[model samples]
Target: MKRNEGSFEFVVGLNRYWLKWFGLWPHCDRFSSHRLFVTLLMAISLLIPMTACLFESNDFADHIEILSKLIPIIMVTIKLFILRVKRNYLRLLVEEVARDWKNFGQLELYEKDVMMRYAKLGRLINIICIVFLFLVQLGRLDMRFEQSEEIGYSAYQALWYDLSPGTARFFIILILRSRKPFNITAGKFYIMSMSSFMNILKTSGAYLSVLKAIK
Candidate 1:
């Protein structure tokens, strides 16, 4: 396949499939405005729970719970920043991969195998993480439900009133927080792709190793 075709397939067709399924797609568009909006939304989502925990929750356990939630959000935020900075490099790398796969004769099979393995592994890891996060959210919700029943409160009341089931806020928090996991997954995939590409170049006796020497 041509470089553009291959790059397009790998990006829009493959990588984004799971992203969309997980509701973590970054909503790639021609304009930077949409990305900025999404980033703002994610920031607000993270801040809301954190603000609640700091000023509203009096219990130490509440602090722990909020901190736990913050961990993933922080991770995702860092990854998104990394991706935004490296966006051009990532695109060029994809095109390079396509060119090498198509033009390199002896290394074609090895290149294809390595790329496929890493891609599959990355996708698998993303799926597992997504599923695990979902389960954790579900468990938090179940606990919230039980607490709400005991306290004779509704879900919304539990959240609004800072009751035992206030963790129910996690639902809305996670919906807006989707950017974190999406960016994290995309970041991981990008890193793996770059690593695999470099390894292939080194193994194939390419001068690309010079780039590594500088780093």
Candidate 2:
């Protein structure tokens, strides 16, 4: 059923008034399509270490691994929430910028700035992932050297090596898509960015614990 615009506006104003009184107004909108994509990417990244837990038969180890995965998952979820909030903020920002949009050059300049920022971020993530992959491959080589006398690295080890880089790449894409801040970082408490290496580390640690248990 179609509702009257006047009624709809009245309801919105009422809600806004209440929300403001409750200190809940102006909440960010983090549920946009871009944010959803980022969340999925982060999830896939966390799944990398999960493959290690698969080889273990010990329930206790599996449980620990499960616990480890929780942190990154939660962090990613929070990031999604923040992204939603940021989207709401963007609406306000666009409104502010719109008045200045009368000049075609200014609008084009803003678009150019946005594209440049994203492009740079993309390059940075690609470089980081490349480095991460190289290190992982080196570790795999070392693992194989030790296992040469045996089966030449167990299936679990091989899978971990394979999956980790892919997971890292997924995170890179996630960061790219999420519009997460790259330059700015905080102490251990937070990355000061939507998605972060710290989050990946926390999640990877949990999965690693699980893998260690299996081993």
Candidate 3:
């Protein structure tokens, strides 16, 4: 539906665009061309690297490397699949949001303005979370050792490894048969996040001066 920029449906329509782009929306038919297009992309982008990594992962770091790079794609693909499976419920929720906007539309202009202000604020917040989500997900597109998802990926990696889904079960069993945590630990800790490392670098001059004094 075409709507004015200020119309409540504008935001809802934008949301629909994203949902459709992610393949969990609008067209849920078994033979939807859009869904087919996205499914092929997911299979090509998600499965191929995962399978390659599973076979090539000879050590924990290798596993972590793949997990860090693939975890976001895995997570996003899973989220879409789950939502796609529950499309009926998702449709109901979207209708509820639109229905609520209909109720607001009946109010006085000032009242509608107040409500739109809050709704737009909420939409802004949603965009922020999406920005962070995208930052986390961006790690998956690269095959290199991206630090963006290392911390969160290990958490999910443990979950994926423990759940032992399909080939991961046998692959992990073979690779981690006798591996210890410290064997893969740098200074007895996983090199999981770069955020704190930035903080450390920010204070390196102070630490350097202290080291010079001690010498």
Q: Which model scores highest in lDDT?
A: 3
By TM-score: ranked, best first: 1, 3, 2
The residue-by-residue lDDT of candidate 1 on 1-215, one tens digit each, is 45535633553455566434333345554545455457757776887778677678899888887887777777767766676667677667656655654553445677757766775676677768776776665556555544544443232344544534466566556444443332112455542233444575687665557667777
Q: Poorest 10 consecutive residues of model 3 by lDDT?
A: 177-186
lDDT (C-alpha) at residue 65 in model 1: 78
**Candidate 3: tens digits of C-alpha lDDT, residues 1-215:** 22333456645655766776666665445545477466758656776868698788799888886786577667766776677678889888877766667676467889878877877887887789877775564333332244433544454456465554785666455445323221222585644334444556678978999999999
RMSD of 3: 14.7
Candidate 2 wrong stretches, greater than 4 Å: 1-60, 93-215
Candidate 1, superposed: residue stretches over 4 Å from native: 2-14, 17-27, 55-58, 101-111, 153-215
Better of 2 and 3 by lDDT: 3
Q: How many residue pairs clash in each candidate?
A: 0, 9, 0
Cα misplacement distance, residue 80 of candidate 2 (Å): 0.9
lDDT of 1 at 192: 26
Model 2: per-residue lDDT, tens digit, 79-166?
Answer: 6557455656745754443333333243466674664465456556666776786566555455544444333223323444356776
- Record all residue pairs in model 3 with backbone atoms less than 3 Å apart, i.e. clashing: none
Q: lDDT of all predictions, in order shown?
A: 0.58, 0.51, 0.62
